[model samples]
Target: MDETAHALGASRTLWELVDRRAGLTPDRPVLLQGDRTLTFGELRDGAERVAAGLYGMGVRPGSVVAWQLPTRIGTVLLSFALARLGAVQSPVIPFYRDREVGFALRESRADFFAVPGTWRGHDHTAMAERLGARGVFEAYGALPDGDPAVLPPPPADGTAVRWIYWTSGTTSDPKGVLHTDRSLIAGGSCLAHALHLTADDVGSMAFPFAHIGGPDYAVMLLLYGFPAVLFEHFAMDTALPEYRRHGVTVAGGSTAFYSMFLTEQRKVPGQRLVPTLRLLAGGGAPKPPEIYHAVVREMGVQLTHGYGMTEVPMITMGAPDDTAENLATTEGRPPAGMEIRIVDAAGRPVPAGVDGEVRLRGEAVCQGYADPAQAAGVFDSDGFLVTGDVGHLRESGHLVLTGRMKDIIIRKGENISAKEIEDLLHQHPAVADAAVVGLPDQERGERVCAVIERRPGTGDLTLATMAAFLRGEGLSVHKLPEQLEVVDALPRNAALRKVLKYKLRELYG
Candidate 1:
């Protein structure tokens, strides 16, 4: 990495880093949506004006402000405006409804709440008023504005908790993950360094701007001085033209995104889907090894998957030059200063190649949850955060995830990994997507159920056919799926597009 990029990791505050980058590349585009371009200089000047406006409304340093906005230039300006004032900001995903949004607002005790008014046929302003939210206002078309002289100096301390990002509530209520400016910077540094990006490369943000990745990606752009295209609503047909127009070189959100791009490529065989695209990289969901090979061989683009969560946005990432085997089978290696520990049930460290709970500790890790009660049981004695994922580290320091602890299915006292079966199923020519879930059963304790979305133009797939395919792949007979259900599509969330397994269990259990 270059000296300027390395120096970004040492920035004490998010606003400071923004200022430094803007000064270096004042005229370069920092954010783009449609025809609206936000140059580095405009980003700083506009945010300060909005900060002054917020200050006029009695928002001071350390004040709490929560916003649920879509992916737009206005949203980016509002976020930076809050950072300029050093206010504690809580960003809720635009797709989250009352249940999750109410919990976040109440728990965070936000003094102000910003919404997009009417978005995607939903009236957020009405909901905010109905929920009795304090300081409810719209930030879609235009944000509050005032004189910059009214604002105080930007915050100097970076260790203070200023960000509260919520987890996706798949099985239960979400928890608010607390973060500092330094932690976000550290996480972004990991991603920027691993990708080996240059200022000339163009990126894209297809996911929600409210996600933890929003700030993580913005930090990378600030450090590397590159611009990224933002999508308000991302669809394959509509997004391709914009990507091509801007010459997007790096594009990906997660494994689902990779699959989508691959599917598009298959439509017109022997033609590159996105001609300028060279790399597909992201994290947030488990990637099947076969999917990696398909992208590299078919699309002719390098696929480098990674491992991360809301608590720590960027944990481990695959580099562009990693070995094919390592990139396919492993989630890549952690950068310098990140410590990954695989521990047994009793909290003892396991040997390399042994599957266990994944624990992480580093500058990038979140401070804790917003609710103190929820934070009590998350960290180990040595300060490592206990991640519920089950994975093992290879001797070469690469991470190999098996599955989640709660995702393991126990049938007749034998444990079965859902990810293992899902990975094998993904290799099938007829299967477009598959999720293996355990259902309650009186005879075997729990029965293995395979829910699949078949590829277009494929014939019906019965339980017998799936079982036979698994057997041919050398899967143990005991691990064979006992039930099968083919659906049009798998249920997924808005951000990261991760399959909502809990919803699948609700339907199939």
Candidate 2:
């Protein structure tokens, strides 16, 4: 990690650019949270007041502030507020449970906590007391306070740990990924170029602002001098109306949100409220090809898929002009200002068409993990972040992800990824969703297990039937699942998205 950093502007931080934009696009909509709305100027002013308020509460620069808020106007302000003051913001996802929340708060050693006075109909005042964070501040609304604001001076010529975010603990303990102000701004630029965003565009975000997806995308729009409509949740009934109301052209969210929107469209035939909507993008997990087809065919909106992680957020994204094959298979090529390589277990670069661990190094990549020991564990001798994903990069610079290095199913001798079977499960007409995982077995170290969610009124999601379908799909004998669990819905996080295979492993495996 270099000690010095500089924003591409050579003189501005991300918040400074956003603050400048607030004055440029003063009357334009900056955020839309249920019944509430705020323009760019209003959002900036609100963030200033909130920053001032946080400062009065003794939130000095370099303070680790834990923001435990849901998606909304206030959440956005708190993020920029902390950034503007040079305080590090560690966000607790709104859907986090006691264990997850407690772990993050304690591990981050937060100096202050911010939350909505009320969230998702829950009283945050009571919730914060239970969570136990210092200097709890209430984010009421986008109103200006007459109190004097305290703005922290910039880092000594070269520093920016503006925020510390962790991975969505799908596999192990969340790795704290730190981003400097310069790197965060660079990340937004990479995403904006890949998405072809412009100042004339209007974006509607559904993924939580606390994570990489919303903050990166929202910053891209704001930095490019565009307007954005922020939503606190992914309620289809409300999201559709909000998009139509704001004439939003870009719809950003997770695979779960897009899947739910498709499900809703099927239920309510002939509902075209947001006809002017142009694009729909999904991330947070590998998207099944079927859902991609339905979104484009039915809604007549361009369907874009993104693949990234916390270590090197925005690694690969499907460009606006990528071919269907490129979009469906690879996660598009590495965006500008990024470099990628496929290497074997020994860390030697591999030839095209061979699977190996993917390593990435670039401006978008983080300097190191927050935990020194964790950083030593993942960082290689050559200073590259070893992403545990098993994939191959072609000569054309496109990548084909075979599976994850850690998610492979080991049978008697063969190693396999559950993604192949999950893709096959999507081929089933009655199967709404599926996740394949490896379960311990007495006979073979580990065996395959499939957890499936069947559509309403659909029956016969039996283990034997699914096996037959896999066989028909040409799955090998050893690759077949030894057990199947059909349920009304798979267990998911607060976002109502499923990827917690570990949770299922505890329940059924």
Candidate 3:
């Protein structure tokens, strides 16, 4: 990063970062949505007005406000407005319904709630009323506004826990992940530095603003003084036009996003999907090596995948200058000050290249879970957050994730890696997506099961054929899936669309 950006990154709070960036380039655009554009000056002024209106609604410093709004310019304004007031804000995904939404509101003890009213044919206001959400109000079109003069000073401290982000709950209610402005800024700085982005680059936000990535990406734009096109709903058909219209150079959200672009590029192999696009970058779900090769070879863009979670938004990120071998096979190296410690079952440190639980210590790590009980046992004696993910550090400092600890399947007394099989399965011409899961078994404790979502115009993928393919790919005999089940589409959460493996286990097991 440059000295100016480095100085901006040091701002004490999110609102302070916004103010500094806005001061340098007040008229420059920071957010774009179709024909609408929100400049840096407007972002600062508009947020102050919104903060004043929120204050009129009895929202004071330390007040908890929960918003379940889509990815839009208005959402960003509301978020920063809350930051200006120093309010503790909890952002729930817009697509989340009664169960997830109610859980966040209750857990945060929100003094106010913001909804989108009836969005995508669902009445969120009615649902909030039914859930008995306090201080419910709609924030779809015009947000609450008042004079900026009435607004109090922006927050002075950035270390206070002011943001509550929920993890997508598949089996149980989501855990409230606590974060501060400095932690979020550090996470975004890691991502921005790794990507080597510049003010000339135009990015795109195709995911939900309620996601933890929202702030992560927002901080990038703030630090670099660039603009990103906002997509309330991302679909190839509708989103393509906006990318072209705004000249989006950096575009991606996760592995699924890369696959989507590759799928589109395949339709017209001779032409680029987005002529201005040069980089595909994201991190949330696992990225298969085959997918990386397909994107680089077919789509003609540098594909950089990273490893992150809601707890830590940017753990490690693949740089564009990384070797093809490393880019295709491993998640990129961590930035300075972000510690990666691999530990065994007994919580002992393991050497590089050994598979173990990934423990993290960094400025980007969250404070802990909202519930004290949920936060218990999350960190080790060394104060590193014990990520449930299983990965190994290469001697080159890159990260290679095998699979989640829960995804490991022990069949016939032999532990098997689901990602090992799934990564190989993705190379199959007939498979669009595959999930390897463990099913309960009386004799062996658990049996390996492969769920396949076949590619278009492909024939049936039988267990025998899948086994033959894995064998051809050099998978060991004991690791072969015992059963195969085909599905139209795998279950996924609204944000990031990460595969809901727990639901698959519940259905198949």
TM-score of each: 0.82, 0.76, 0.82
What TM-score quantifies how close candidate 1 is to the native fold? Answer: 0.82
Question: Model 2: residues >4 Å from true position, as ranges?
Answer: 1-12, 34-36, 121-124, 140-158, 168-172, 267-273, 407-509
In candidate 3, which residue pairs get closer than 3 Å at backbone N, Cα or C atoms, i.e. clash? none
How far off is residue 270 in model 2, in Å? 6.9
Give the alpha-carbon lDDT of every model.
0.88, 0.70, 0.88
Per-residue lDDT over 82-122 for candidate 2, one digit per residue giving the tens place of the 0 to 100 score: 77677888877675545445667777898877767776666
- In angstroms, give how far residue 321 of model 2 lies from its true place: 1.6
Model 1, 194-308: lDDT tens digits are 9999999999999888989999999999999999999998898999999998899999987668878888999988998889999999877657688889999999999998887
Candidate 2 collision pairs: 71-232
Q: Give the per-residue lDDT digits (tens) of candidate 3, residues 336-361.
A: 97999999999998999999999999
Clashes of each: 0, 1, 0
lDDT, residue 405, model 3: 62
